[model samples]
Target: MNEMKTDTIETIKRVLAEVRKNPDLAAAMTPSTDIVNDIGLDSLQMITFILSLEDAFSLEIDFETFDFDHLASIAKLSDYIAGRMKEHV
Candidate 1:
C-alpha cells in the first residue's frame, strides 16, 4: 500500500485501541472492517469513537459536514480522516 494508506491505517488502529474494549477486534481490524455493523458500536460508543478519533488526529470534525458512510469501514474512516487532515493543513 501507499504511504498515506499505511499511515492512515496506523492512525485508525491507534484510535481504535484507545476506545475499543477488544484488543483482538482492534488487531483484526482491516480496511474492510465495518465500524458500525461489524464492530457493533452503539450510539454512545459511536460518540466515544468519534471523540477518540478527533482527539487522536487533532481534528475538529464538523458533524454537519460529515458523511455517515465514511464511518462504514476502517478504510473509509482512514480516507475520511486523511482528507480532513489535508484540509486543515
Candidate 2:
C-alpha cells in the first residue's frame, strides 16, 4: 500500500488500541467493523475514541464537518482522517 494508506491503517489500529478497553471489541475490529452496532461503544466511549484518534493524529476534529457515519468502520475513519489531513495541507 501507499504511505498514506499505511499511515492511516496504523493510526487506526493505535487509536483503537487506546480506546477499546475490551479485548473482544478490539479483536472484532476489522476494516468494516461498526463502532456503535458492532463494538457497542456508548457516547462516552465514543468521545474517548474520537479524542484518542485526534491525539494520535495530532489534529483537532471539527465536529461540524465530520460525518458521524464515518465512525462506523476503520476504513471509513481512515478515509475521514485522510480527508481532514488534506484540508490542513
Candidate 3:
C-alpha cells in the first residue's frame, strides 16, 4: 500500500503533515527542512511519526542500531527511506 512508490519525499511529507497536525507545514517543507531541529518533533511525536511512517510506507524501521542521523533533514530521510524500501523490496 505504498501511496507514493517512487516518491518517498511526498509520502514522507504527507506522513509528517499528519503527525504534526499542521497541513501548512507540508506545503512549507522543502527537502532541506530539518525535521528534528526545525520541525521540532519531540519524543512522542517522533514515535508517532516513526510508527505512522512505517505504516504509511509499509515497512519496519530497524531501531536496533538506528540513529537520528537520517532525521537531519527531509531529503536525507527520503533517501534513507527510499533505500530502506528498496531493501524491503
Clashes, model 2: 0
TM-score of each: 0.87, 0.81, 0.87
lDDT of 1 by residue, 1-89 (tens): 89988888877876676677766666778889887787777788788888888887899888877888987888888888888999999
lDDT of each: 0.81, 0.76, 0.84
Provide the lowest-lDDT 10-residue window in model 1.
17-26
Q: What are the runs in model 2 whose C-alpha is more than 4 Å off?
A: 23-27
Candidate 1 ranges beyond 4 A from true positions: none
Q: How many clashes in each structure?
A: 0, 0, 0
lDDT of each residue in 1-89, candidate 3, tens digit only: 25453378887888888899998888898888889989898899999999998998898888863578899888888878777888878
In terms of lDDT, which candidate is stronger, 1 or 2?
A: 1
Considering summed lDDT, which 10 consecutive residues are worst modelled in model 2? 20-29
Error in Å for residue 17 of model 3: 1.2
Tell me the TM-score of model 1: 0.87
